[model samples]
Target: MIDICEESLKLQEQLVAWRRELHRCPEVGLETPLTAAFISKKLTDLQIEHQTNVGGSGIVGIIRGGKKGQTIALRADMDALAIREDTGLSFASQNGNMHACGHDAHAAMLLGAAGILCTRRDQLRGNIKLIFQSGEEGPGGAKPMIEEGVLEDPCVDSVMGLHIGNQFHEVKNGQVGLHYGNVMACLDSFKIKITGRGCHGAMPNMGVDPIVIAAQVITALQTLVSREIVPTSPAVVTVGIVNGGVAYNIIPDEVVLIGTARALEQGVRDQLAGRIENLVAGIAQGMRGGYEFSYTYGYPPLVNNEEFTKGFKKTAEKIVGAKNVIEIAKPTMGGEDMAYYLEKVPGTFFFLGSGNPEKNADYPHHNARFDIDEDVLWKGTALLAQGAIDWLENNGGPA
Candidate 1:
């Protein structure tokens, strides 16, 4: 609010550099040693207090203002995916990992915010915690960080995070996109194995065919969403990978199916899981093949806290202009590990548009051609800085 706009513009150049450096050396999951070291070095240089090795390569930077007030947290994920780069840019990923999810931009923008906040510490009303988390891609890094006391000592009053989105052009120009509740789906992975007797392929009725039984199970599982689950409630049960059979002449003795289920409602998730197990077991038994199913629940659906969301809405309107702030009507089936953080503390996670057709940055996330509009980097940096400051000043205390 204090003409941080100009500061943001100046920091744009710095952010570009930071982003390129990170882009060239992308790391995956909890093994972001280099990424964490870079962030720590920058925070240290800015005289910001921080902690390291939190929840495996997670780092937290604390900036205490001159006055006593509230504690607000701004988070950014630092993990990259196991994607090979094909963007053909000079600064494209040298390692096998790529920032297809735009986490590189998240880290750089937060570092930029750190710079602005450090320079204007006197104007700050409270404490700001910058969370550089790793392993957002899977095996969730957020829970471990929270367990390591990332949310304590200072005890954050409220927290916020932003993800980059390519859809919905009406809210372009790095606008903040917020949803009141159930912003992302809960993910659960499952594997089903069918056991049967092997026999010659040319023989008929000589043995049980696991492949045929597995196919029947697949068709039945699809019915869970289209027929069994409520139409109004969203849910997906996809059989992504199926493994069986060794030779054309011999019928395979067993078949294994792997897939995931996604749902916005907790009941839907549980119902689908139960239905899958029961249906698969019943079908396998009826077909003279024994089947077993195993499911592991992934991240829970991201439910944005309404109290924190109200603050974030106001903050977004002020920082990026009111016209740029938009409310997303429908939630995405995609899941975020940030749900782990929100589960422990009240927080809001929104989207920052990185799409710019003019710059050819229109590809969706995880695509080999994916790239962000570098120009929006400053806007993101400013938004995070302004949001943290606004939340602390308005809330007035950690409690």
Candidate 2:
């Protein structure tokens, strides 16, 4: 095996420079023109061939090896959240958006890995597909990229991706967390609209109260997880936004409730949706109000292929030492759009520990103060490059 650690260490300065540069200007959603241009420029500098404007700002870089073998893919998200930056770093974003989820680190590490893999192309046994995707925090860029045929032409046999941070606080710094199955939960969003006649506060029962029905619906939705679904199975039904009354004296004509549902198993996910619709409809009818419930299926469950995860664990252990490789005991309810890629291909999505108490880089993802330990950036680079090399060398062909 190549000395991935040494190669990655040699490029640590470059990786940090790239990460900070991207951090200064954060973009959100699928329309990431600047982020795409930056990634394209880096790939061009490396002499790596790539396709641009893929799935609305996504980029795909193709690095062919000297020896012929099956193609493997490595992915990184490129979009930031809509949150304002609060890290207070000199390189922190000033555009009102933040890389609170460590996507900047993900992109920089993948670029570092691409550079290393490009230099060692002659030593590689197969091709490496570098996927720089956008819009992971929102409407999702993976499904559209797949529709654009990012996985075709070269035909990717297996894939791998990583996230950086203390998303799961149980894992420590320098550790790589892996799980065999259901690494991340499936995500589905719901919006409930209840309509009722407007009435004055002075009157007791003059009009149907949609706000009261919405409150009941929200409370009942919680029981779907705690009472309806099996205790061993994980499920979540949270009402994040509730809008109803416009004034203290008058009840509004309509109420809107927006929230998300999450589950590890598909059966439970479907059950949650069905029960939610039924309960909302029945409650609205009983309360003499009309309602509309819209459930949109987002990303599916991210299931790590057993065989690929085993191989990835071995490769990670070799790079970061077995002591730093942690096998996660349970799956997280957090949803990842990378699950869309795993749905069609065999791959594993793992997490890299980016928390450092000494450096105060231990904030959770999505928080404005969230930040990753930049020191771990090179380790992620080495992990992806070495993992892909080892998999190509061992598997030789598609699994």
Candidate 3:
């Protein structure tokens, strides 16, 4: 035990500074140039070796250990949402973008872990990959990074990552929430464009009314899970955006329906896309309307390896207390690009509850006013650092 907790505590001020500084000037999507540069500079200051511009604006830093062992990766997402900052903190973003989902804290904590691990490179075990990824909020960064071989070179044996926030209500403040399997749902999206002849509102019968067709399509889309899928399975289909009609009195030529679908199981995930397209095609054709349907398979369901999660649960218990390590009763429908990394490697993604009513940090993720409790920041650093150390020690070959 290298006193990672104490080391993390000592680095608390630095963590707060880095987080708040990153918070002040947030960036968005795949073009996180400033954020990347900041991360690169911090890695450089720690005297760590790294590569830049990986998978969009992502960065990868390598910390080789003193002895012959295996490789483990610790990941951190460094993108912000498009929401404007409303959190009244002094270091809040003045720029148009905001770190509404606590990515700033994630990046800062990984940076803290990087500093700690770099100092202990001669202690024992193998290597650690410090993955500072961009574009987790939109066009995914993990897939491109994997395509570019971030999991290669040294070749990672196990991976570990954590998310900070009160995204799950049962996860109490400062608690580490863990799930054995199916931690999150797949993030899949679909779009449908219904074409009908423009007509006056009073005489919908005179022309093929797209509004009527679209309404039926929307209503029926909901039943895909309620009626078609198994009742016990967790799935969701939500129409977030519906675009049509510019004028009040005339029916539009076309109505575009865009929505997201989430499923925990691959069988169900595969089924949703085909069924949605078929449903739309049938409804539009029977209603005398034409439709264009496109379904995009986004991040796969985040399924944690039960064995790896058991190991990480112990690691988390050591850093915090066993009582502080909470087991999530079930998975959430929320989607995470972290799922992509887990898909390629045997890894686990856990949550850190940073919500506190006293600190007023309980705002929902993606909300403009969302914030995280700064006190538990170091615990995150300790968890990542210790997790890599422990996993590599046990699985790091005949070192």
Best by lDDT: 3
User: What is the TM-score of each predicted model, taking all chains together?
Assistant: 0.96, 0.98, 0.98
Full-model lDDT for every candidate: 0.88, 0.92, 0.93
Error of 2 at 145 (Å): 0.5
**Residue-by-residue lDDT tens digits, candidate 2, 84-190:** 98888989999999999999999999999999999999878989999999999988999999999999989999999999999877678889999998989998999
- Give the distance in Å from residue 396's predicted Cα in candidate 1 to where it truly belongs: 1.1
Evaluation by TM-score, superior candidate among 2 and 3: 3
lDDT of 3 at 240: 92
What shift in Å separates residue 92 of candidate 1 from its native position after superposition? 0.9
Off by over 4 Å in 2: 397-399
lDDT of prediction 2: 0.92
Q: List the residue pairs that clash in candidate 3.
A: none
lDDT tens readout by residue for model 3, 1-399: 459999999999999999999999899998899999999999999999999999899999999999889889999999998888998899989898999999999999999999999999997589999899999988899899988889999897778899999978888888999999898999999999999999898888888889889999999999999999999999999999999998988988999999999999999998899999999999999999999999999999998999999999999999889998999998999989999888888989999999998998999999999999999999999999999989988887776
Candidate 3: which stretches are off by over 4 Å? none
Q: Let me know the TM-score candidate 2 reaches against the reference structure.
A: 0.98
Order of candidate numbers by lDDT, starting with the best = 3, 2, 1
